[model samples]
Target: RPAYIGERVVTPRTPADPTADSDKVVWSQTVSLLLGALCEKSWDTEKV
Candidate 1:
């Protein structure tokens, strides 16, 4: 769920960086999604 949400948030920023190449921009969003997922996973795990 956080992956999906983060993807939505990051998707817009992905194309916003005109200074960066397309591949780099895409990679940024991928990283963002991964981080978001990790954060959510950690939070959920801590609750148990």
Candidate 2:
């Protein structure tokens, strides 16, 4: 877990774990879903 040190959260002290192509695909999908949800909420449907 990451720790908060007053103003900033402490970065990981070790190297990042290796991720495979499948992991990247899943991560991008998750990110796109979150971005889409945010855009939908911010869009004005009545004006569309």
Candidate 3:
């Protein structure tokens, strides 16, 4: 794969066993992204 200028690749290794700590981090990210999406939707609706 050719790398483009300023392009970066990130790889995150998964744990052999899913632990509570890792799950919590993933869940928190999910929640934050969901909230951001919801907020954007509401803001767009309000602007309409």
Pairs of colliding residues, candidate 2: none
Quote the positional error of residue 35 for candidate 1 in Å.
0.6
Rank by TM-score, highest first: 3, 1, 2
Residue-pair clashes per candidate: 0, 0, 0
Q: Per-residue lDDT tens digits of candidate 3, residues 1-48?
A: 886322321222444545754665676678779999999999999999
- lDDT for each residue of candidate 1 in 1-48, tens digit (9 for 90 to 100): 346644544455556665565555577789878999999999999998
Give candidate 3's whole-model lDDT. 0.63
Best-fitting candidate, measured by lDDT? 1
Question: lDDT of model 1 at residue 15?
Answer: 61
Q: What is the lDDT of residue 31 in candidate 3?
A: 78
Model 2 Cα lDDT, one tens digit per residue, 1-48: 754332131232332633444455566678779989888877867457
Off by over 4 Å in 3: 1-18
All-Cα superposition RMSD per candidate? 7.1, 7.3, 7.2
lDDT of each: 0.69, 0.55, 0.63
